[model samples]
Target: MGFPSISKFLFGPLVPVLRIEGIITPNTTNSIGNKLRKINTSRTEGLAVVLDSRGGSTGQCQTIRNQLLQFSKDNNIPLYCFAENFATHGAYYILSAGNTIYVNPTSIVGNASEPQADIDFSQFLLKNQIESRIIASNPLVNEYRFNWAIKDSEKDKKFIQEITDRISKLILGDIQVSRGKNLKVNEELLTKEYTGKQAINNGLADQFGTYEAILAEKFPLAKLDHTSLTQFSFISSYQWNSRFGKAIPLFLLLSLFSLKVFIKYTLIIQSYLLVSSQEEGQEKEKKVQH
Candidate 1:
């Protein structure tokens, strides 16, 4: 058996360290949800969440935060959060659920503000001579579409404002509830971004530490098992597309070559099979004639 397997066999389950990196989409929620459900709570000593996201869908973030909180409460295990790079907006909301939130000295934290409304691409489309038509049952629904012109109605403005305000309040409320007395800053300050050091000073983060340090300090005897909802292969493909956009043509070329080779081999096999069948028929005729 491998070292990890051997170690687990001898020492029981290792501490599960789940990562929440990238945008908080429904996919993110589902991935984490499945992993959370699979955790062996009986053998698990503690859970650590590594957050490095610039925020995403508000609903998805809230869902994941709730799931983590519930898991910790139900299991009665310490849930620690380690913020890397940046954990802002919806990401910070999820981070707040941690019993203790740790950050690197330069880690960007906070930004519990209202969600940014969808960008108006109407001007860009107009400039590019693209006409986008939305066929909606209700005329008002056109205003919600991305390519629609900005609505002039006060009612529309108020409705949009209300949505953003409610979302901001929900996020702030959750952070306040989770951090409790530990939160020193006001709502205004909470909405602003801060470095890890500033975050600790403002009570946004508990301490300055990395994942390794926290694990060593908190779970000295326990082995560390890093868990991610996304598979390595999917992440690799995503990274390839994101980082090497220029290489896409090369990838497509290779794919075409592979397809061509497959087709060629398929034709060759088919021809061979057809020839063999014809030869067999000829043999049968000869045998009948004999």
Candidate 2:
């Protein structure tokens, strides 16, 4: 009741504004996509899609990207991100799809890199139809198509790197073109690897200001339902405390499992040594008797 309800439309039928402040995934894509489809079909007066997510799946990001591009292009909607605490690689990649990117000076942006290798499907036995399609069309499978569940082959790793490299180049080019000035930008700011001054100096973001200032300039009554607040909006949902080790990446989890296995083996080795020592003592007593 404090802030404006997202359920309540603030603007005209033309402007179907959606906030993307949390994790963006395929599931989220379906929800947002459905809303956009309805809004577009309904013929909204103007559409202003605001993306605020830190980013999620590559496939989902692309899905949102394509939809936004088409919708914005058709309805003259401008997609702009108000870069917050962190907007990393995939986050920045999705923004490039926007016609224009607006950021506060302190807004963190940049740090583009090849998307992390997810899954490998080298031994993947695609059905005849799918295999033939791949062979015939050979879509850019290497770019960002890994399932992360599949083990990657050496060749697959190399291909993935190549595609990520290309995507990185494309993003950097976008930043350069947007800046409209000739300055070398590391182009990795989106990877959560940039400061406000660094972002401005590099030209990844325009200026820095509080949400109040930035939004007021654009959206007069720009009220934000912070993800933290919106999270409680459901009231019926459960909440959990943030744990230090819980945020570790999946690869790290695998590493920890391997380490535990190693420790287990060390204990087994100790047991083997104790048994061997006892056997040797018994054998020595028999030799003395001889």
Candidate 3:
């Protein structure tokens, strides 16, 4: 048996609960990836992800989804997802990676549509009397400027449409693959937002339940290790010690340098004020004597 297997055999089973909150970004992916890599899979009964995000970065969403799916497969552990408040856009994309998705009765699910590309700030800038300038080596780059008018750019429209199509394909493909025969709705219906009850009915989610209750029912014996995978806990334990170990000294040095500069400037200002006060007093005395 492996070291983790031996350890599990000696102790007991553990269920790792990872909470993903806020906007999904590269850092989110990195934090989750690092935690997954460090998990002792042999002892793990299953992996549970608690998602509470409004969604962000489609590319990051796909990357994180792939990582989660791969981790579950490689570890031979069932992956459970619990959507708390909402999981729209890229968050929904990541949510579809779960083997079994659980949601609260009021949870918002789905809305995996293509992002809107046309974001012209020209009107707003013009109203505020702000003249935005774009200076680029390539003229093609100017076409993408927020201040530039994009009313009649057929090429830009076509390019945006192509990108949206690809993004849609990737997101919808993953959802279909993960949900498989359980997914009841068509592609058109999948793009619409639904409540937790509606989600289960449409096969977007498996059950209407909270994280604690679901985990309690599913893995009754396994202890939930929620802190291990949390960003703050992980950083404090691992990153702070190892990653920032050498950098701490440098940080202190820079802080001390800043403090020294501040003190020198303060002394200079105080001396100038004192000299100015003395000069004014002498001038007033000379005027009185005259």
Candidate 4:
């Protein structure tokens, strides 16, 4: 466990800082969900989430966004989120679920780019003078192959476009519902990216502030409480992974030690049995000779 984990576990009125960094996969969503469920909000003012991600899986992002919304509503507490570096695509979708969003001046708020099925590998293949062949019953299966020669058909292109449009609508709808009149949802704004200051002005973010600044202002007297040592940090997949990462080596060592002892005992028992059988054989041979 890290210092932050220990500090959080001490039952102080500390604002729980949940990190939404890296790829938004199932693990990431599970970690966030764990923290939301374990947080003892009664001892704290509110929850603060720091989001710094380029983007991630859209489905996972939707799951996390829904979880955050439900957590805020169920707790009847404010869930503040701050965009640290770049909160675009799926990251932006999750951020919108928070009660209020804050951002730094240089923070990248939104980048509503649609998902694309095609990746250009023509230049690399040409430079390497390599030819690739893909054999599949389904055309869609061949899409995963590195075929610079193959061009997407009209049907496939339309399918991709439809999915992209649906995802965009879902994300935009969530933001519109959450931000309400504060956000002016126009085609131009949704398609383009915005900086932290621009995000605040456009009502995509509530204010331009960092996590520390908001925490200090909201919970001024939240200091260390040394009276209780029985508290625990918010349970999250990240925390569990952190502890598990450390425990793996120790568990391996113990397993190896047990295996060594078992082997040693087995060898000793085998040797004793072999000696006893040889003695019995010698006695039988002597009796036959007599």
Question: lDDT of each prediction vs. the true structure?
Answer: 0.81, 0.56, 0.81, 0.74
In angstroms, the error of model 2 at 92 is 0.9
RMSD (Cα, Å) of candidate 3? 19.5
Q: What's the TM-score of every candidate structure? A: 0.70, 0.50, 0.71, 0.65
User: Which prediction has the highest TM-score against the true structure?
Assistant: 3
lDDT (tens digit, per residue) of candidate 4 on 20-94: 887778999888777776666565567777889977888888898888778778767688888999899889888
Residues 61-158, candidate 1, lDDT per residue (tens digit)? 88999999899998788899999999999999989999999999999999989676566666777788877656778877635533345423666667
Q: How accurate locally is residue 41 in candidate 2, as Cα lDDT from 0 to 100?
A: 28
By lDDT: ranked, best first: 3, 1, 4, 2
List residue ranges in candidate 1 displaced over 4 A: 1-10, 124-137, 142-154, 228-290
* Rank by TM-score (best first): 3, 1, 4, 2
Residue 97 in model 3: shift from native, Å?
Answer: 0.9
Model 3 alpha-carbon miss at residue 193, Å: 0.2
Give each model's clash number.
0, 23, 0, 0
